[model samples]
Target: MSRGAWRDRGAWLLAFMHAFVAVCVLLPSAGVHAAETVHAQIAATSEQVAALTAVLEARLEPLVLEVTAVEAVDPAAALSAPPTEDVARVWITLDDGGATAIVLSGDGARGMVRQLPREGASDEVLREELALVIGTAVDTLRRDAASLASSAALREELGLSPEPEPPPEPAPSVEPPPPAPPEPSPIASLPPLPPVVRTPPPVEPTRWRLAGMAFYEVQGFAAGQIIAHGPGLSLGLGGPPLTLGPRFELSGQYRLPAAAENDVAGLRLHSGAFRLTTQLTVVRSSRVLLRVLGGAGLDLLVIEPFLVDARAELMPRRVRIAPALRFGLDVPVRLAGEVSLRIGAGMDVDAIGTRYVIQDGDALVPLLDPLRIRPLLSLGVDTTFVGHPAFGP
Candidate 1:
């Protein structure tokens, strides 16, 4: 309410406004000075540029260094430009010989040239080496700038005149030394060593092979008009093939009994066989094998009759054995590892013929006629193992 009090309030407000305006104007300039910037100009292939930039950034991450990629018409001109206090410029160039890196800071320009390794090296390795060189140069520039700042501050504190120092003259480029000549052989003056004796590798002795197979077989008896099919197992032992002779295998097979029935008389015919065979390998390769087989065996046949008519009299079951001769061709294809799929077709000739019949009242109805020839088909898996002879070296 008093005049002196109002005048005092106005003066205080004016002073506060002037201070706020000063702070607003100076704060941004201080922030801009505090933040340092690094610009990188790469003059190399695209692959080199990408590799160098990524590795350089990773190496400088601990320093919170920010790298900005820039394109320059002349990298030399960029490197030679006047340096700023808060900014650094790096120029990297790749050539056939190696890489060259130049860094410019407040202190001046620093450069490094690295030669490629004499031995052939990959582009990735070369990029890493060049990136390391550039990183070292940048670190040196930072140290020099920090040292100059400290020296200037110390001089101002001592109240001495802050005199500017001229930039140091650039050092003359030095060429890399030429490669040294190869050393002379120590044994050059001595008589030539005895001709190196080379021995031939020993030949591997032949080994016997044991083979086994489990199969499902189908046999058609055309003469008797019956089909019999069942599972069979076989085992064989064979020697390796000779240069001019076929490989031989002696095998034995036993087929389980399988049955076929006649619809009219309800007569069931069951048959099985046991055979001894000798197989000769005609063609054998890694992928496929062919063999011709011949053998002799015994065939067993059984017959049973069931009649539905009340007056029909069924004959008792009968079993018969007949000698047989077998001839076949087998082909085995390798599936994987030591396993093979075997397929065979064969024929059997019976030595004796026997007939089967059923009795109904006064009628004698034939069930199966004598079987003279039977054709056979088979599919199986085969495996073999090789072993050295028991008594031979």
Candidate 2:
């Protein structure tokens, strides 16, 4: 078979095997992982939203009551006073713009109030408006009992019926039986009540953290290509704004390639390269992460082409581009106070160099095509130096 045909067949076989293994095995596991990841993120988001909404609701409760008819009935009483046995229910509604009038009626009382939200102000304004609306009605009732009576009369005139009164209790019968004798003394009565137990207040969790990482790499190219070995470094940032997870990262690495030759085919010389990488971690847990990284840097290549006889072609250094891909675990170490470490493994791809001369005739002929690909394996570690403290017990 021609050389091109043989290369294409080998490539197809490799691709098919990779597909088979991935579809039958890796894909199923990955699908489960994806589902779990989505569930976790949704759960975390829901928890945060719930907590925030609770706080807002609690703060707004007093304000809502203050502006409604419930407070107009008795606004002078201290907030700490025991609630009256006769409860009055009131419901209030506000427009989206926060500018509107509301009418509330319950317990034979009815009132209306206007509400407004000031620009560049907090919800405190809402509370203020609520007080003003309810306070006006209370003042009107206190200053002039006649006005209150008049309002009640006006309601009656409008055919508004008063609330119904509760039924009266029945009188007791005559000629009752004699009372029974007392049975127990204080000492013989029920056992003394157990001492009231007290519980300590709950502690809040720590909510800050930082992470760091480093790695080592080994790479080899296809036949007639070069091989390289090197180390890489990475720094990561994480915290509450990023939803209490690690995301931002910066990394750099250097690699050295080895040279070799085949007797039947030709000679090859490897080159050295340097690369810088950056990644954003989309999702992360204590030990694992789903990340996406991309970066471009410089690479240096040294060439040694093969000749027909015994001599070979040599060329000067050339500059090229380098790119990488990463996927791995970031384990933590807690040897130092509030400090941690990370270790990981991933794959990388880079452009080695180009080809120019080939052994053809008396003089070396120029070979136009020169693109090359390299496959790499890497290991890394990181230390948290300037990061926030992660949440813990």
Candidate 3:
């Protein structure tokens, strides 16, 4: 296009743009004015309602109001017009029985009971309710006063009653139990005797005893040439006492040898014996006693040789007897405790030859010379099921 024509069109477009800007700016101011006018109207209505509410309240109870104003810079100041208003309302209903009072403002939209009526059904009903409440209060007060009066009367009566007398206690008395019959002495009941009581008089107590021992021995002339004399268990018994008021007892004992003799080279001598004994119990107490024992017995000895070549042989299966003596103490910790432990030591004097003899190499030799006089010591625990209180009557 030509420059002149283009310039003319540009100018026309500029003019139209300026007109649009002007319209946009003016339209906002118009709308703001309209909104401010509406708000002012709302404010006026709120004030009128508040005023009317105050009037209703005053009629119900008394009230008052004061108003004042000030000025400030505002764009709406130029557009300000006279204050516009409309009336606001409130309603109240009061019923005393059925005839409700109807005091109201001119529009019937607002009112109050500034004053109540005198005497109708509603008035009488209200008075009656009030009377009923008052009567209940008066009745409660009368009951409280009557209770106080009754308490005072009770106090006066109690003060007039006589006091009671105290009770008396009885005296104690003494009485003796009837005398028991006397028991007759045993001698009074016996017939005339001829010097002695005979029938062996009476035995004070029965007696019992035990005797035994154990031994281990190895004999050899040099090292690695020893033999085991196998271990043995033996026991002896003493019977009841004899004449002279418990002087003697009959006793016996037996022993057996064990099977394994550790000796690997020479003869292993294992011995067993039995003896008959007599004992005397020396009376010590109703439940305790001491005793001395004497006895004689027989024994059997077996000699076995287990050679280094694994061969074994048995020699002289012999029988023999010997005598022994025993002395010991018996202690009873408690008469009826059911348990007792006795400890004793004694000696056995054996006449060596009667037992066994062997041919060692060339000459005859006593196999077990019986040790002549061997000492015996032992401890034993015994239970007397018959004598203990738990077992006795």
Candidate 4:
């Protein structure tokens, strides 16, 4: 072929890929994993993947697109796509008309939606088509990457390990043995069949319905002269993918052995807090869910003191609302229906870093100066409410 012929072929190829991938880019957003559905799986050889990836990146770079590569396999068995596509998958399906490039998009929302198939494609041609699929995924990723960057659950859900299924084992070859004496005196009747039972799949629940969350947390406070550890109880409400919206929580904590003077000093510390939090799901699957959360809270802390000596004297205890910021990881195991057992681990940082206050005469002083970040791990239950709560008409 002449230089002009090659140039024409290249131009046509580019135009064809652009048209093919354009369909994927324009599809409607379905689940919250709209962008992730495009995070893809491909069926091809390692060599084919390398060649395809190079071509895709070369073309996608000008458009500033990025895509992750799942491991490639032998192209011979790359025709049938995976059984389920939690994320989009790309492969070539065969018909009478040679090879057809297909992209199965959506996370079950649009179940195995096929892209515009290309016909009579070669290795080079198929590479171009697969690259186009990733390019389309990159387009939507731009819209969600910022919000998803902080979500570890979303990243884990997109775990694109496209390990090729092992090929079917070949049947063993056998030789017939010589038969001796054959005696027949048996009934030809077959045994009765077992009863057939049908199990319907559970209705998939939407994540953010009105969800209630409860958990136990252990809070710690320590500094120079003060060392305190306390158990806390937390309850929260919010929903519609309970992990996406703001949840209001009320929690209370208590620790013993506080310092007090003059007559009474049993030294017990009590604290209550109201927190507003939002959780970002990093990954959500059939059996488990992972999330990262951020929130702000005000702690209403009260101190009770016990005097060691009979002659000790001091004013009343002090109460204050210390502001704090908290970060957490919530991992839940999805139970049967709309219920989940949640295990949460969190850390709280006091904004002002001041320690617990003690009563000295009529003034409040730092009993545990320079407070530290509190760490807690909790087990809880989460459930979604039936109807949306309605405020006034």
Judged by TM-score, which candidate is best? 1
Give the Å shift of residue 225 in candidate 4.
8.5
The CA root-mean-square deviation of candidate 3, after full C-alpha superposition on the true structure, stands at 37.0
lDDT of prediction 1: 0.66
Q: For model 2, give the 10-residue run with minimal summed lDDT.
A: 35-44
TM-scores of all candidate predictions against the true structure: 0.43, 0.34, 0.30, 0.38
What tens digits encode model 3's per-residue C-alpha lDDT throughout 291-344?
A: 565656554556564443354334534333343333333332223454444444
lDDT per residue (tens digit) for residues 173-282 in model 2: 68778888887787876889899999988855334435666677666544445456677676666655335353556665565545444442343444444544454556
Residue-level lDDT of model 1, residues 263-347, one tens digit each, is 4455666667788877777776767877898888887767666765546556688887778899999888888776889999998
When 3 and 4 are scored with TM-score, the better candidate is 4
Candidate 3 minimal-lDDT segment of 10 residues: 35-44
Order by TM-score, highest first: 1, 4, 2, 3
TM-score of 1: 0.43
Q: Model-by-model lDDT, in order?
A: 0.66, 0.45, 0.37, 0.54
The per-prediction CA RMSD against the true structure, in angstroms, equals: 32.0, 50.6, 37.0, 45.0
Give one digit per residue, the lDDT tens place, for model 4 in 278-310. 766567566787778888878777866655666
In terms of lDDT, model 3 sits at 0.37
Better of 1 and 2 by lDDT: 1
Q: Which portions of model 1 miss their true places by more than 4 Å?
A: 1-203, 222-225, 242-265, 359-364, 388-393
